[model samples]
Target: MNSVKKIAMLMCIGLPAFVHAGEAMVKWHDFNDYRDVRATNQAKGSYHKQIASSIEKHAIKLAEQLPKGYKLNLEITDVDLAGDVSYRGANEIRVVKPIHFPQLTLNYSLMNETGKEIGKGNDIKLKDMSFMDKIKMGRDESFYYEKRLLTEWFGEEILPKIN
Candidate 1:
């Protein structure tokens, strides 16, 4: 039993090496200065922080597609969520109107393990004017439109440049 325990411990020690993959560093500008990030009527509190956290998490997730030792640094300068704020029955609500669309302005740098820049973009504007026209696989997801916009940008713009 002692020998088996030693083997398990050894395996556990080595697991982290295998689990480490590509990394992403996402930074956000001042939320107060952003274009729009209004919370829905059901939001509890800290709506700005919630949206920032979601965007950061999704950006990191998309960076997983990079090569094992690559790193992506993304700095988001502005954000405008895909809806308009309105009042309904004395409650503030976010209405997904046809005019409102998701927009983001960002800068990014992709670097290899040696810390050499492989690709970079400045003032990259991302706008999804037809955000509502696309079919969504995760309709109930939080920040669905924003996430999709990032995914499309990462896949089409960043991935292509790097590859």
Candidate 2:
């Protein structure tokens, strides 16, 4: 009876370790864009494009940094723009035109080769602040901020939990 109990305990402990021994790979799928900014606005379009591109680049970097022999995959499920607004000023005439900043929400899923979800992260907010400040200063700053956010999220929240 004791031997059977010991065997059950060992199986429970060793099963997951064995399952995790296989190599892991990560890939990114399509991402949703929920921002309401008009495509005609060149500046807004450029900004949005940069954000999307940066996210993809960072995803690849994070995947490469994952521990060896563990397979993982990331799929972008949705991107939700929470809100956006513009400010305009005039002295009986249009001087400084309205500038807009968009708030974004991203949802993603992390899974393994078995089609089982290992972990999922959602509603990660990426806020656009170009409307509040000069483009020269805001553009580079926002890009760096977004990059850092992605790194932290993947390293702290996702990587550790991955087998």
Q: For all the candidates, what are their Cα RMSDs to the real structure?
A: 4.0, 13.1
TM value for model 1: 0.83
* Model 2 pairs whose backbones collide: 24-70, 24-71, 25-71
TM-score of every candidate: 0.83, 0.45
How do the residues 116-160 of candidate 2 rate in per-residue lDDT, one tens digit apiece?
A: 777766656655455335333334543454455456666677777
| Whole-model lDDT per candidate | 0.83, 0.51
Model 1 scores a C-alpha lDDT of 0.83
For model 1, residues 52-157, the per-residue Cα lDDT tens digits are 7888888888877776788999999988988888889878888887699999999999998788998999999999988888887855877888889899988887
Model 2: how far residue 44 lies from native, Å: 3.5
Best by lDDT: 1
* Superposition error at 153 for model 2 (Å): 1.2
Instruction: Tell how far residue 111 is off in model 2, in angstroms.
Output: 1.7
Q: Where does model 1 exceed 4 Å of error?
A: 1-20, 42-45
Report how far residue 10 has shifted in candidate 1, in Å. Answer: 16
